[model samples]
Target: MHMMLMADEKRLCKRFFHFRIAACARAHLLRRSVCAGFLTFLIAAVFCLSLFSAAPVKADDKVLRVLAWPGYADADVVNHFEARYKARVEVTLVDSDEALWAQMHAKGTPPFDVLAANTAEIQRYTEANLLAPLDLARLPNTRKQLPRFQALASIGGLTSGGKAYAIPFTYSSMGLIYDRKQVAVAPRTMRELWNPRYRGKVLDFNSAQHNFSFTALALGYPHPFQLDPTEMRTIAHKLVDLRRNLLTYYTLPEEATAFFIQHKVALMFGNYGTQQVELLRRAGADVGYVIPDEGALAWLDCWSMTRAAADPPLALAWINYMLEPDVSALLTQRQGLANTLTAPVESSDSARIVWIGPVENIQRREDLWARIVSGDRSERF
Candidate 1:
């Protein structure tokens, strides 16, 4: 039977090639070179089709659809994964959490197979029943991560009802960034952004969640995420102070890097932490990164499979592949963020990182943040 199929394919290719050559010769209106090239392409296609006709193609072809923040699934990274699994990988980058949420919830079911999101964002997806229950047994690489992340159930948003929903991948703090040439020494605390000397020379993140939480931290609010009414007012006043002493607020890392160089920005709220530092340094700026004495807010981005995923085992394989040392090392080499596979020297275990959570009132904070940015007086609060 196999010999008969091969003979049929060979005969079909011969007939197809002869027809193409005759057709090319009849095309007197076309350039001779162009017609010859087209004929050659047809012949090659026929030959290749005949060679691969016996192979059965899998329905999925192990297509791994990934949705993550910029730098998480870069071209080189995706290419490596694709080569290893002999699979097709599609990566979608989202700049903001809201954009991620919008993309995931665009239809009834999320389009992505696996998504990298923060703990808070994961909670939203879980509540909406958009995430799938993870099979940790398939993800043996999770065991190779740091001991702190080994207990997924103890983590606030990772595990629910005895089922693990996500696995930790990378994390970083919203530290302070200062131009070394402008500032002789590293800024020890986040409060330096409020220093009067650097007034009109400082930049801040343009998000309410970060603005409010960091201000609450600087104001010594015991609970930054769940601030009391009085704490809210005080934090608002402090935020107004931050606004008064700023050049402008920026949202994207690329924008911040450009503005820092063009404006000679002295200090900035490093919302993207080491990621921004890498961008600035690459742009030929001398800078220093410091996690303030008062502690900096941090985010842990994890990988979770979407409920709409077509192939569960393939999704798990991608997660396990990412947890590999070489792949995780790319996080630091390419993006300058800390991966969870191993602990780094700069990120001490004792360092204080106020993990982000659902805020007491995101809407109220956003409204107040707008007022503050518009030059509302402290007494107005």
Candidate 2:
């Protein structure tokens, strides 16, 4: 098992290297080389199909429907699966866990075989009995995953029992993206965001999750996920207090990036996905990002197989395929997030600061965030 896991890791690292190379040599690949690579991939697909054609039929065989974020599983992934298994995929895009839960309840039975949601939301779904037991025997890739990831998947720290639930997918962290030319130094702690130095020049997330977590960290809270009533009150007051100093509360990273580029803001709370910081640096804005020492919040999005999956085997197959090193690297690289199947490649400086590791602390985040948004408490931080 260890050998297999290591092999997958090496494969992931190698593929990540190729992705970096490809990114740098995109122009060269574009003119004529890309066609040859595509042809080779197609030929490989044909060979895989022939090899698997004689495999015994499984009990669960049908369209492997999935609910995921937009642009998650791309064309190559889809084609690889369809050609090999001769199966169909029906995809539905969802933006939030609340929306996903609503769909499950409204449908009575889950309409999709596989569901993608953040690590925190999976807890809610599991409690609601909306998910099925994940058979680890079927997911060899899970073993090669990082220890922190395994801890996140475990329910209260038990491996096997907890393992029977969700498969770890991708992860990212909340960080500060700033215009370096406008700021003298990067803030090492969440409290710096409130410094009068950046007052009215700070962009923030309007979403309850990021907003609340930032305050919780600034207040020296032990864990964002373990917010008590007093902690919740403190967070609410802090946000209300910061309102006057904030330039704008943004819902999307793009909006925050736009503000920074336009010189409307100097620093903003941002996640790992943006090319904004990089672009700003190149444009002479002196920009960069940081994962504050206050212990930034990290999130993992996983693939949860619904209990009512109409095609269980096919769904499992898709999950396994996604665990493939190269495939996982492609998704993580493009999406700007980390996942179970791949490790962070240091070539991208953002990868070093991007959020990784266990999500056990997230449960505290959810509750504290809820309190702040609901206006349930109003004490000063």
Tell me the TM-score of each prediction against the true structure: 0.78, 0.67
Q: Which parts of model 2 are misplaced by more than 4 Å?
A: 1-61, 106-110, 143-163, 272-286, 347-381
Write model 1 residue lDDT over 1-381, tens digit each, in one string.
Answer: 999999889766644543453354235224545857888999999979986984565785878789999888778778888888888888888877767877886767437999999887787789789999998899999889988898897778898788889999998888889999989988877888888888667888877788888887887788888988888898888887675567677767987886788778899998888889988999999999887777889888999999989888889988888899888998998878899977775763346778887788767987988787665666789
lDDT of 2 by residue, 26-67 (tens): 343354456678898999999889878867655564578888
Clashing pairs in 2: 134-164, 180-286, 224-364, 224-365, 225-364, 225-365, 226-364
Judge candidate 2 at residue 167 and give its lDDT.
Answer: 72
Residue 342 lDDT in candidate 2: 57
After superposing candidate 1, which stretches have Cα over 4 Å from the reference?
A: 1-62, 107-110, 370-381
lDDT of 1: 0.82
Candidate 2: C-alpha RMSD after superposition: 16.0
The weakest ten consecutive residues by lDDT in model 2 span 350-359
